[model samples]
Target chain A: MDTTWSAIFTEMGWGMVTMVLNLLKVLIPLMVGIELLLHYKVVERIAPRLGWLCRLLGVGPKTIIPLLVGLLLGVTYGAGAIAEINRRTPLSKRDMALLGFFLFGCHGIIETTYLFWVAGASALFVSVLRLLIAVLVTAAAARFFRLAETRKE
Target chain B: MNAFTKVIVDGILRGLKTALMLLRVMIPVYLCVTVLKHTAFFGVLAGAAGPAMRIFGLPGDAVVPVVTGIFTDEYGIVAAMSGFAFDKAAITTIAMITLCFHSIPVETLVTRQIGMPAWKMTVYRLALAIATGVFTGWLAGWCF
Candidate 1:
């Protein structure tokens, strides 16, 4: 309410429209490519190599590319691809939560570098520490879930 | 439709639907933030959130980047910190928390798209960010 009519229209109207359009431009292709990947069986091939690692994290092998891609491409562009994987795969609730842990902490190498520069923080320290924490937390979660499973059994 | 054509159309439709779902969260929150930036509400918020910030050893003003980063992206925190002279400890502290938790509204929706509950995901990020920040802050305060 404190914002002037002009500010609201400019920031909310055209601004939001542009953001939505830009997001779609990246997301649509990623989503479509995910479908294409399924058709091509790309995920099936790569997923096998990630077997033990994925199990250690308690996530589906299908989550590997999205987690890796999220690290490299950043979460914004990777979100559609990740959501596509979740839709196609029968990942468990704990696996989804673990994926959330992996992606949220260590996403986007470039974004991290840029913010590191702006914040004048150490890149090695920030990125390495984050990756370490992600692995530890996800491993801990996986261990917790496995304990819960054993208890149920 | 052919199999290939079906894939294309279905993917496009699914993508569009996902984008729309995310936009529902982004648009209103973005507008609200734009409005808040122009009001005194932000200052009051910074003050209200300041005590919680000491665990990370950052000053009250660092709250700006933390909140901005939560709602937006790493770039948002970068932009907020551009004007400040926070030392390396504070900078690293802020970076850890924001790195874990940035882009909350939109990312929360995307996480929800993957079937994680939004509130739980948000809480996970926030709690982890703070715990990490506090630990790192304590470590940094000792080292530097």
Candidate 2:
């Protein structure tokens, strides 16, 4: 215990501060860019292409920006987009639950890429596996949410 | 506000709010992971978690990355993973796990605001991460 405490002070203390700084370096800029995109309502233009997939995912057009943002960027950014949707056009509980499942297995493209690069991980394996899991879980969630909704009705 | 002005101001305010909210979770978790690494508990954890990680073809120390990735971000996991000589297959599996489950603290907060249960999102991500890790681990074993 004494050695651990001393080690924390002498070594891990500096490591903690540096790691947090490293996180801010990546996250802050991403958040700011996402906020600006939201302010400009980029989703309005970008989401049209998501039409075909929307029905399949059980999410409406409103969920596109958030879902894509989370899939392509970070979940925090996606959450911001989803919050915007709730403020404007609320999603059904089923859709919201469905989205939770999709974002679970897939979020943050760059983070995944960086992990692959730094950790000697294979890009293809991670990408394919995550996409597979995301689609499967999302499909199951949609089915379950739909069944629950029907029962409620 | 003019269109140009609105974009800048809204971004600044919204970004600050989002960053602060994220920091609330990120900072504490970062500190906890960092401090834990300095303690003996990390080794004990690695010992216990080794078997589960072996299911993904990873060594026991890989637990640090898995735990860090779940709670924090890529950097934490990267920092945790840097020293080890993890093979290509183990790295791939770990990457999938981190991509799926990293930043649970902030992401769950976001989900709750979007009208889902935070715990549900966390559970969903974790389950999927595990599934994918297993899948990739198997793939790695088969291919190489």
Candidate 3:
């Protein structure tokens, strides 16, 4: 019983340390990059070009940074991007919620799909299904919100 | 050069602050999961959620990895599932569920920081994940 308790504590300690370290390693570099990009107005230049994606997700053009970051990176990193962007140029509540829904369902697509593929699952199947589900659900929610707004008006 | 240096410093500081905030969620959840794994409670949970696997057309054993994935992360799902022998369809179904739902506690906190309420985001993801899992199950069975 005592050994089991010690083992549990040890595992917890190690897990927390590793998790935090991993988060910092990726997050610090990512935050620096975003800051540099924003400082140079790179995001502004890129945001307009992603109009098609903005339309597809039914969000504003300014959301392209966070949306792409969240899709390619992971949820936590995406949230970082969202918060930073929101601080700079406020996103509508609707846009934030839509992004939350989309990313929470399917962030880190390539890495995740690749991991699963290496684990023996079909790469095409997992990646396609995950993206499809996230896109469909987010698009449906956006449509619902639009209809509700029109009804109110 | 001076402005660039300031931006770099600001970014690092912000990153550190955010990392600290995240640790507030990650540490406790990690401890809880570790403790749970050391007890019979983990297996009990697997058993309880086992029946629900049928909804996704997954086997009972898939619950172990699915539940682990929810509390932990994608790596946890793979690690837990290493002991099992799941078919292609089952693997795909499980992947669908975990992809949508993994790292629930930490990710929910991250979303909560960005103006979405924690409970609302959690519920939304859980519902969407289950729905996707079920759909993937049916689709996988038909296709593969």
Candidate 4:
């Protein structure tokens, strides 16, 4: 290893500049888009309408709130919302687990996907594959737990 | 709505804050990884881990980001792997896996609070992340 530490740092400094610039380009627009979506209450309106998705995830209608929140805002916020909801009406362990699994596979879709895309992954691949995997795992678990048939009554 | 302008401003602020947060961690990690790549230790470690990573169509050095991602988050992974060269397939695999399971300690608390056991969620996520990595590796090879 003939390369000195300072030399590596100098190289890394240049690399960082380029990387940060590329990241910011997409990130700024993405954050703006997210803010617009939130400001317009897109998730709020769209979440409740995903009853079929809720059914597919093997949870009741209310579970959609945390699922959507987690998908849009990331797991912490989504889980925070779930904690709030669970306090008012205790959710079943199965419901919580299903939500956890699904969100684990695909959360913070907009930012995460775009960030990875900037890092060289395909945006569509990251977003679609994660969502697909999340759905598959959650739906399978829901079936195994016999909760998928819990449609809106 | 008049508030639309405020929303855009908020977005820009939020984006700056997030970029700063990521840079705080990423810059140091990137520098460290870059230095480590020149070290004999990293070479040995990479050699040992190479086959395991090869299963996912990644080089051994790729483990740095994957493991960093487990302890930290996507930012850490990005920083850790900054110096390495990977094709799109490998990057996609890493992204898919890390996205499935990152920031375990903090997120595990969220899961616990939400009524799921921390250990269970952790295990599920790790398993799913690996599964996703393998699947993405295969898919990317065929597609990308």
Top DockQ model: 4
Q: Candidate 3 DockQ category?
A: acceptable
Q: Is 1 or 2 the stronger prediction by DockQ?
A: 2
Candidate 4 segments exceeding 4 Å error: A1-6, A147-153
**lDDT to native, each model:** 0.73, 0.71, 0.76, 0.83
The CAPRI class of candidate 4 is medium
Candidate 4: which pairs clash? none
DockQ for each numbered candidate: 0.39, 0.41, 0.43, 0.73
Model 1 C-alpha lDDT per residue in residues B91-142, reported as the tens digit of each score: 8888988888888777777777767778887888888998999988887777
The TM-scores of all predictions, comma-separated, are: 0.67, 0.71, 0.71, 0.92
Tens-digit per-residue lDDT, B6-76, candidate 2? 66666557646655665565556555666776557879998999898889888887887787776666665
TM-score of 1: 0.67
Question: lDDT by residue for model 3 over B25-79, one digit each (tens)?
Answer: 5565556555655567768876787779888888777887787788777756655
- DockQ, candidate 3, comes to 0.43
Worst 10 residues of 1 chain A by lDDT: A110-119
| Local accuracy of candidate 1 as per-residue lDDT tens digits, A1-153 | 545877656755765665666557645775687678667766456656877878777777667877766765578656766677767776667767787888776777654654474347867668778888888898898898889989999
TM-score (2 decimals) of chain A in model 2: 0.67
- Higher-DockQ candidate among 2 and 3? 3
Regions more than 4 Å wrong, model 2? A1-43, A148-153, B1-45
In candidate 1 the C-alpha lDDT for residue A56 amounts to 71
The sequence of per-residue lDDT tens digits that candidate 3 reaches over residues A1-153 is 898888767766665665666667655766686678668877457767887877888988777888877786566667888889878888988988888888887887755776676566878877776787778888899999999999999
Q: Over the stretch A1-153, how does candidate 2's per-residue lDDT look in tens digits? A: 787678656555665565455545555555566556666677566878878778777777777778888887667677877888789878877778777788777777655564465457777666665676677777777777789879999
The window of 10 residues in a row where model 2 chain B has the poorest summed lDDT is: B22-31
